[model samples]
Target: MFSDILCVILFCTLHFIASSSELQPGMPNVCADQEMSMLGARQPCVQAFTRMVKVWKQGCNSHRWCMGYERRTAYYTVYRQVYNMDTHTVYKCCPGWRQDGKEMGCLHRVCSANTCFNGGQCAETGDKICQCPLGFKGTQCQYDVNECERDEGGCEGFCCNTIGSFYCKCPEGSRLGPDGRVCHDVNECEELNGGCQQTCVDTPGSHHCECNEGFRMHSDGRTCIAVNSCSVLNGGCEHKCVDTGNNNYKCECRKNYQLKRDGRHCEYTRVHCSCRPGFTLAADGKNCEGIEMEIVNSCEKINGGCSHHCEHTTNGPLCSCNHGYQLALDRKTYSDECVSGGACCRHFCRNYPGGYECSCRAGHRLNPDGCGCDDVDECLAETSGCEHDCVNTLGTYECFCELGFRLDQDQHSCIYLLFRKVPQLLQYTAALHSRYVSDEDDSDGGDREVEIQRGRRGELRLSSSIVCLDGSFGDDCSVSCEDCDHGVCSENRDQCECAAGWTGIICNKTCSQGTYGPACNSLCRCQNGGSCDPVTGKCVCPPGVQGLLCEDGCPRGHFGMHCRRKCNCPNNGHCHRLYGGCLCSPGLYGRLCHLCEYQ
Candidate 1:
């Protein structure tokens, strides 16, 4: 039944109202009730509806005609007699004029009521009563019987009452039952009188400890102890033992006395000489003097009182290294010169505290800027090596193979080494140089014609120099057309044409998209400009545009579709080109200013 109703509503809204082509002068009503007709005498129906309205309007005036009742269920009937001509026409026209084609349909909803529990309903028989579930009982179901009450065999300990519930508390030293009922003894003596130190006395709900006489209450007020100790002055000093109460104390010697090894005797003795570690026995046996006693100061050593490497001023040993010598690992002086193998690289060599260091070879820099050697990239023009790739290995440079050739290990120059003909020894080197040289080739134009042509399978050459030396043909007398510089390569002369976002002989530097200027430096500068090709960094201009580099912004009120037409919105809607329309601004409607109504 519910499905059928929904289908009817859907059909009315979707087909009848949506499609103007589906309208007809008269059609049979699709309502479930048969009594109601599409066209009926409207007078009697209106009268009945008016009376129904009066009964439902609780606080509304009857004359106002304002609808207050929920039109949940609809009743339709064809009047046999014509009650009023005006009403008849109204009834006939009403169905056709419905905005959604679903007029006069009815629905039913749950009714409102006062009886609720915890914000929920007390339905059916108990209309206005709060219906609480089990374990709950009260006038308003707001309170529960305190099972924990003192009388109802309740909480044997303490009682706590809450809304719709109550809890039990065990006696002072007992625990409440699992069911929250009776209280059980804790047996304070079991856990050592709750950690107490004496006999435990269990009371109704609590317990107390009985400590022996001499013991005072501890912080916990439970433990006991012995009566006397060394803590008490003269309390237990049998042989002059310092009175230490609570079983702890120390024995001290009387005044003018020294404690013996056993901590019992006190005796007075004269001076004795047991010299310290750093000092030695003096010949007199009454005084101690330091060993190795030299009689010179630092100033005296400065004035050359000592020999070659001695500091005789302060009477201490000297501190100096022999000529061309430095301290060895043993801190002993030795004259030594570092040979080529041990000499430091370009950096200066100084006599260090011990040993020596060798600087690295030339064309090399230090690691961490100054600590270790890192071969310099001689290829960098600034560093002044070869004009090309500048690969810096341990100590030397091997001229790299140009774009096409591979470098010869023995000759120190580039050589024509093919993957199929030459050994794999040069493969790694060829790959590196290719990557490095290709980046610079674009700026060096001359080779543009070689890109377009097809060559023998895998027979592509890297440079025209290779071709010149090998005597190959393909016009322009250049080398392999495989990798050309100018944009894309022209098959003829090793030539290439640059693409967008790329420049120089070969497509090297990447140009930013949505930007176009010299060297692709300046952006389009046009606000709301469409993004050009990402690679070439060009701007797609709309029609009727006039400006150098397309940098001028769009004119006011005229936008979209080549900036051809003026914007059209009711009042002032934000014009959106993508949608080909304007979004009416707040308090506006219709295209451009066509409609003048507030939102």
Candidate 2:
């Protein structure tokens, strides 16, 4: 019996130990911190379920008991469930945003065409202007326009701009590229060899640098450094070594020196040389020449060694100097004239090698001697193209017209006035002395037509009486009147009684396109931006444009310039283009015409 009892005890102890080992939750099954995104786009993914341990009566611990009766404490395992929240804390980027490299936060994506400044606005979208006016973008308006993409913002070189303002930028040592969608060549060589130390070779698409003949490329590539020195190889030459092509060399002698028979060495060869009669050898013991020689038209050879021009003549090497220069003592070189006070031009003088030239300023002419400038008389020279009279001033000229005529758009010709009517008494002149015409108000209060002041320079004003019904003076109005050249002939043949918008020999022609007045002398005086009748000079104003020249906008209740067009708009609705219907702003729906768009 004792042995059996001991066996039972041992079995119970082993079973109990095994049960405890099985219940050991080592790492809680590795419940990793997990998360899920919420419905809100801007909301961050956050802890979904609580990260606390699950301990709701996970069954009482059978392995051990506290005081045999205390409510058995439950065993539990810890885990984490994440829910999306608090956008600032999220590790992932939201829609429309991306992680640029290892940047701490997501960066706004943009195109790489040009510099992207700070601006994005919905064109006509109401209210909901922008979440962040300067930086952030929310979807209220869709269409966008950046200046860089349009005409390159008028910059002949590369250009960039945001909706607000712009700042031009280029990498150092670079030039602004042409504007628009044009493919052009940027002369890299133009900007100081494009940052190259030596020769800069440019191609249609690229450029590069090259070293000189006896130079080797440096580590920096663009710069060039000389070779170790010809002493390295001696070149097997006695005097100097010259490199021609790859692996090729040649020997040369110094001035007044000659090479030996072996071609490897050089020796002095200076000695007296035989020359023609009247000639002597130079100090170098080489060349021989004479002080004077005779030759005809000898300019072809080396341009006669003249600094500027060589005159071909029977004489030998007839050398001459250019305009602003003078022949030097040697006659082969030239010297500046203005440096020694050769300038005598009245206005300004420019000097060169052999001579100097004088010129006049604008509105002035050079005198006959070519050394002085004088004010030109425009009237005497048929200049200014004046139809009536030319008045000469200090350095300019003015054009004036007769009393009945006005200056034409050409500023030189004179034409009849607009809407002229004959009065009971007339005061006028054939010729006046002043230089310019002054405009003064006429008798009518609303009239823009002007009348000139009385004669001041002892000019006469002829007062005429109405003898004949027509402007003609000879017997039966047979001859056409000079004053009625392009005006209508009234029943009595009165020139001033002619109707408006007539032209031609007898004022019978109608004014041509967009022109006004019988002689088409006056352009329409319509203020604002109104279009005028070519013949009658009547103004036609556009909708919402008011005043004589369409100067102001239409009022709320009406549309046309005269407030003729009326509309029925309610709930703070506004008129459409022609005011034919109503248009609402943001909130109101349809007041008659639902023309407003949401975004």
Candidate 3:
């Protein structure tokens, strides 16, 4: 029953649509060929044809009356043609009008009423009606189908409805596709990256902007800017912080400080203290003090806990013996039972506080090895009793006079010999003769020669000769001498005298050790194991040492020749004294001026 009802409802809806289509004035004819032929014959057609004609006439009457007098006359002319067709008169219809059958009923030709709207076509049926095109509805297609209400008009973005038509639209950053109903990404970035400051990316129906590494987008979402890593907390550095590229930073410390394990804080590298022995660190950890004081004080509080007196020293506490008591082998104990036999002392042994002292007799002194005694040399000491020469003995000294002199009542004084004046005169005469010989030798040798002699009265006498031979001197040409090394020979004197600094008669000896200069009278002052040049009096210093006396060491950045030569070392390097080449620092090589090995 329900199926029948549903079928009836469907058939009724279809019938309504068909009836509505026929209501238009341009509908096509619905009559069959037999009915059309019977209408054209002299006898009338079936009743159904008459009913259909009556309906057409009623529609025409109503349209004519409503359209005014002019349309009514035109309708009447068509009605008369139809009525006259019953009389079998052979007549023609007006232009754009035609007969439905061969002899009677009249109707409009195809689309004769011009009643269709929006490009709809008009056709002839029993009555004229409009045939609407796609996207249109109603008798004249005056209304538009609302495509937007049905699935968004097949548009990817927006839709708009219009009379007899509809169109699709797109939002910003989007465009309509070739289908004319769907939207696609506009690709605004295709032209100059969408005018973005860095990067641009396309999305569904829109476009967005981005930035590259080490940069961030601005508030406008299009511009980019570099990141500043040091702006916050100075990159967590305690002393100094430097910003590198790509938002990175490094930390550094001040002089005398080093970076801590955290890589942010600084720590002191040097502390203030005197590095003394028997000392320990103080509470502050930066100073030092003697620990012996504390130990001594503690020991003193316990009275040293020794069998003798306690003494405080820098080394702590010590046990001492009392008078008449000897320190035992244990050293910490004193014993009065031990008596001295004087065997340990070479002289008089006297007992003193804590130990025994040795005393020497007159003219003798005690040695540092307390058990021995040494003689005091009065001759070398300033307190000698003698005024002149003093001779040292085992335990005493004696005064004496030199040769040709005698001691007075005061044994320290001296007296000259009785014939001293005669000898003095002889010595003076000999000196005068030597001068005369030297003067004569300076003159060019002529045909004469001179000889010198001493008379009985201690006076000098000279003799001359007419001829003199080579290597011989004197008036008789009798004196002779051999050639002298490092010396000049005096032709007149026939003698060789050594030059300065040459002591031997033949000038064969050089200056002795520890002496230099003209006459070998100057003493060497060279120090620090330096050697003095015999001729120049200059000192030659050893390696790593320089200066006149070799007293100064080679300072940094300098070496050789009194430390006057500058070093060519680079990168905090040192140099060798013998060779001026550079010694590079750790991890560096190749003349010290090149790049590091790692680099």
Candidate 4:
């Protein structure tokens, strides 16, 4: 009986160990640190599952405990369930899945119930699609679309299509066919063992070109250079050419200088020169000087002899005869005295200092002084140039024009109308003395027609008696008294006078208070005393008088004129009165003997 108890105990113990080998209550299969799976506890359940290990019980209640026989039986049954759980679906206590002694299910089992579009398996996902093992797209199962068909060339140069990928077209310097669709550069320089003979240059398209010492450029394009110093090489010649840039050169000189047609020699100025008029040679290679005109002894000769007027000609002298005056029959000199009718005009005549003038008749005037003739205005009968409506001025007329008319070039008579309408010629008008005539055309016969004498322009002839009191001459007689440097011609007597301290018509006004005569041409003697005349200005004193105003003569013992003499007195003695000898008073001695006795 003991042996039987021993065998039963051993069996019970073995069953407990077996069940424990799998996931018993509160136990883990693989380490609790293992990654989770949809197969749940068949693999293992971690701590978050409170029933990580399943405990055997008499009934399927959380609080129920197993009986002695029931615990043993339950242990044995749970041990078998744990051992076959992964491959077997039939179970007793664990209704669904059994992992060791604990029962659970595959988390993916419920997901297999749904379908997806296009045969895609419908699997639970977070927010995005979760594909099944060999499925794609829809809930139940899927499509096997080729990804590469969607990507056309994918990029530029050449298309590179990979399994599910595509890459851009790449030419020579690139590499490809990697996990990502991209191309990387392959340095040909490194492959060719360090590139160019002279220098390595990188470029697009292709590389490997060459440049000489003075030039440099990229491999992919053409490159060239030149010496660039041709001008310096030819000694900067006038004109010539060599080669420079890209193979070209030139030689030339500065502007303004010419280059020989030969294209090498240079030249400055192009002109060949001579001299200018009146010029002489200069020391400098190019300049000259002017020569003066010469004057000679022979005078310019003229055709006529002396008459009323004479003018010097280039070769000699020419003579012009006035109206009334003429050259003698010999034609040597001018003469005014003539017979009843000479070369001169009629009634008016006179001989001048050098020539002669002709006087016109009572009702006329000589046009240009002694030149010709014109009528005088007598109508107004002497009331200041005329008295009433003037008749025609004769030969020396008052420039009288008839009613509504004026004199033409021949001032002798009058015309019924104006010679010309322009006023420009009016500038020649002078004094413009005028009068009225009868305007027969208009109703007014004698009171309306005006006549005028347009005398020489800028000239004024005052009455002979009206002279400039301040000593002025000429037409306006405008001369200043105080600064008149030419002295003056007295208005009262036409006398010549010098302003106060000066002399000469223009006064030549200067200071000469102590001098007198023509122009202070004489000295004064105020040292003695004597004033000068206010006009002719001479001193009024006797021959022997001398003083500031000539008030006194020489004192008692002095004589000779101007008090410039003295008596011959000895030793400073007193002289006798009125031509007497020295008095020699007291003990004084000498000629005038006025010395004191030796005391």
Best by lDDT: 3
**For each candidate, what TM-score against the reference?**
0.23, 0.18, 0.21, 0.18
Give the per-residue lDDT of model 1 (tens digit) for 259-359.
55433334675656766434678888888887764454543534342223645423334455655554334332333334222443344442333455435
- The TM-score of candidate 1 is 0.23
Ranking by TM-score: 1, 3, 4, 2
Model 3, 98-154: lDDT tens digits are: 555342334655454566787878754545467778888775667778878988888
| Pairwise TM-score winner, candidates 1 and 3 | 1
Give the alpha-carbon lDDT of every model: 0.43, 0.52, 0.55, 0.42
Cα deviation in Å at residue 244, candidate 4?
Answer: 7.1
Query: Which is the leading candidate under TM-score?
Result: 1
Residue-wise C-alpha lDDT for candidate 4, range 1-599, written one tens digit per residue: 99999999999999986764443333322222233223333334223212233455565456567533222221111211123223322222222123433333221222333434444444455532435443133333344434445554444346655533345666776656463455566554443212232344555544554655544442212222223434333423435545533233344556667754434456685655445434566767577766664533222333344534666544435566767556555444544453223435444454433444566665555666464554443433453242212322222223343244433333344435332222121122223232222233233321222121101111112122224443333222323343234465555533446655566445544545667655566676543334465335566543345444665555434554554344544322234334536656446666535356885
Tens digits of per-residue lDDT for model 2, 261-354 = 5444577985666664346778877888675655545778889878679876643576887675576666665645443444555666655334
Off by over 4 Å in 1: 1-114, 119-130, 135-153, 198-203, 210-214, 230-238, 242-250, 254-257, 260-599
| TM-score, predicted candidate 3 vs. hidden true structure | 0.21
Between candidates 1 and 4, the one scoring higher on TM-score is 1
Q: Candidate 4: lDDT of 510?
A: 55
Error of 2 at 35 (Å): 99
* Segments of candidate 3 deviating more than 4 angstroms: 1-114, 126-128, 229-599
